[model samples]
Target: MYTTLLHQYQLTLSSRNALFDYCETVKPEDLLKPLATINNESMASLLLHVANCYVFWLANSVMQEKHAYFKGDEHLDLTAVRNVYGQVDLLMNEFLNHFKDSLDVPLLITRPDGSQLTRSPFEIFTHAITHEFHHKGQVVNMSRQLGYTPVDTDVVRE
Candidate 1:
């Protein structure tokens, strides 16, 4: 189970990098363009949300086992958004590396509604990666609608 979890984590990390690279290639101007039909958020907004989610989950949920994800207002700065993403990526990598030898240890996570559950650290790691992928799909679709070619972020190919 530990080996399988580690492999999943590695694959997820690769997939995340692929998605980030794809996002980075998008033009800065197009990132803020509004969608015509759907009231979808701008690419920059989505990216910012993703970064913020990562930080909140890592700091409060994963590391501290606290239920609440974030406690702040939305950020609208592109450079700050990028920096947040970079920092979360580095922190996630560091955490994974540190726990590589303790994959079997379970983590206790508390819910915002006051529920408690236990999961392996590997499972929490996988959840974080997959959560990002779920949101990255939205960004990819938004990128396509904004007249940009979205990079192929298929996990199997990466």
Candidate 2:
């Protein structure tokens, strides 16, 4: 199960990279243009949100490590986004390796509202991936609305 889960994580990375590549096709100034349709979030903000989720779950919750993502990420370009992804990937790999033996062990994660929820590392990882996938759809929609059609990121046949 650990190995399979690890494969899934890697595949998710590939799926996400497809979107990041699409981001590169956007005009530099337009990256931060707020899409009035989709929650008013810019393209960069959505990507940053996805990256931050990985850090929050893998680094903060499970590994008890620190993460650094800035609120001014709308200024970040595709290259900077790639750099952030590199850091996040490193942290996630560490988290997976460290918690391989404790997939079912309940971990107490404190929410923003001060509530604590107990979940296993496996569950947390699954949640993080799904969260990103959900937002990826939004990113796609925003890009299309902006006239940039992104490549298919679905993992079904990729």
Please give the lDDT score at residue 6 for candidate 2: 89
Error of model 1, residue 81, in angstroms: 3.1
Best by TM-score: 2
lDDT of 2 by residue, 1-158 (tens): 78988899889988888878778788876778888897788878888888888888888766777676645544368788778888878887888888889898998888667788899999988998999899989988887888886788887645
Every candidate's lDDT: 0.67, 0.82
Measured by lDDT, the strongest candidate is 2
Superposed model 2: Cα runs more than 4 Å off: 73-75
Clash pairs for candidate 2: none
Q: Taking the tens digit of each residue's C-alpha lDDT, what string does model 1 give over 1-158? A: 55665577577667767876776777767777667644656767666666666665556666773333322234444555656666776767666676678756887877667788887767777677777788778878988887778777877882
Clashes of 1: 0
